[model samples]
Target: MQFTQIEYFLMVARLEHMSKAALELEISQSSLSKTIARLEDDIGVPLFDRKGKSIHLNEYGRIFYKKAKKALDDLQEAKTEIQELANIQEDSIAINVMNSKLLPKLFFDFYKKRPNVKIRQYVLPDKLAQQKLIFGDIDLMIVINPIVDQRIEWVPLFTEEIFLVVPKNHPLATKESVSLIEAKDEMFIVSETGQNFRATENHLFEKAGFTPKIAFEGEDLSIILQLVNEGKGISFIFQHSFLDTYLDNVKILKISNPVCFQTVGIAWNKNRKSSFVVNSFRDFAISFLKDSANKDFSN
Candidate 1:
């Protein structure tokens, strides 16, 4: 009946465990249990099918859960609308990106033009970024190999080829191009499985009909490059990821067999209403990237 009770019930329903939900909600287990019991009593039906310590949502609970979630989402949207109206002059936008290196220059360029607008950036894995977009936690996302979703509006930014990187002194370093199968037995370093680059690596290896011997799995691109510099293992990297600093110790080769490439873009939730600042940034970013890509092509 109460908003707090509904919130607690939703959390319990999501986690399906009293102790875990209580810990997450930062409330005592007894209080959480009493709250849910009261909610069930008021509704005149048991929401959960309880068996010992585990609980699962029954038919009634499933129907109510969807309604309660939507109610909370509506309340959150209302709060965002009021906040935007209150601060119409100075606006803030939240964005998530797969790569941190590309953001500094882009954010700086935007900040120089729109000094009053506040920009918040987050670097997250692909799965987490998509989740935040779905929940309306972030206004926009800049990503590569974005999963296709009906709820999202994707604007293409640019595409770049993925390269195979190895230490300059490695056996295959002198080759103009290398097939993925040739390197099947070689030690490889790759990003964590959820990342876009990692997915591309897996696809390339799969197409070449061999599994790579993964020596290290890391999240940071800089560290991955450093590992290659030390002759620890080779890795797949994006074309833009190759900096002059890495040129001395590393050699980047094209993948001849499959010729893989990834398209990076900006994605926004179609259902979430964007604030004025968020709308402005979305337009500006799309235009800016399009222009940049055009100039690169012309040159």
Candidate 2:
């Protein structure tokens, strides 16, 4: 019935775990459980079917969730509008990106133009980014892989071709570009299996008709680059890597033959009216990269 309760309900429903939701919301688990139980009792129906260590929403829960979501969204919109009418700048936008390094540059250039807006940036893996987008948790996402959703609108930001990175003294490091087949026999230092870039590596190997001899595995880009620089193995990176790092011993080469490229873009909910902050940030991000074409990025 209360706004606070509605917010708690949405969080609980989204997570479907009492302890997890409670930890996230900074409330006691028992308090959260009691609150949900009371809400369900008041409605004379069970919202969630509780099994050991799991919770699934029932039919009534689904119906209530749909209505509750709309009500909360409408309330937020009303508040935003009212704040605007009073000449107050009060709005927050959440951005989910795989690369954490891109956020500061993305926001610094954007937020300078709109100083009053609040920005929340999250560094997440590709699958989680798409999941959060579909769940309406994040307002916008900058994803490398294309997320085709009817309710989502995609705007092209930049196109980056994957580069083969090696130690400066390596023979292949002198080449401007190397074909996938040429590097087929080389060792790879790649991300984990479920990661987007790892999948891209798999596809590259599949196209070359040979499995790469992977020498090392890492999640962080710096560590991966360090591994490569130490002559552990070669790795793939966006062309931006050349400009972003000061590692003197690393060399970058474009991948040719297949000419593979990842399409980076801005994605937002099509059904929702985007705020000025979101749109402005979007415009700034696209223009910043375009203006600095062939320039280096730090990460």
| Candidate of highest TM-score | 1
What are the lDDT figures for the candidates, one per model?
0.84, 0.76
Q: Report the alpha-carbon TM-score of model 2 versus the true structure.
A: 0.62
For model 1, how does the per-residue alpha-carbon lDDT over 27-85 read when each residue is reduced to its tens digit? Answer: 99999999999999999999999999999999999999999999999998888666654
Residue-level lDDT for 47 in candidate 2: 93
For candidate 2, write residues 1-299 as lDDT tens digits: 56777788889999998899999999999999888888888788999989998987899999999999999999988987766544377667888865534456757866566667788888677667767777778888876665677888777766767778888888898888888788777788998776667777788778767888888776566778778878888887775443336567877887777777676777888777777667666777777755453354323
User: For each candidate, what TM-score against the reference?
Assistant: 0.65, 0.62
Clashing pairs in 1: none
Ten residues in a row with the worst lDDT in model 2?
290-299
Candidate 1 TM-score, C-alpha based: 0.65
lDDT at position 183, candidate 2: 78
Candidate 2: residue 179 Cα off by (Å) = 2.6
Q: 144 in model 1: Cα distance from truth in Å?
A: 0.9
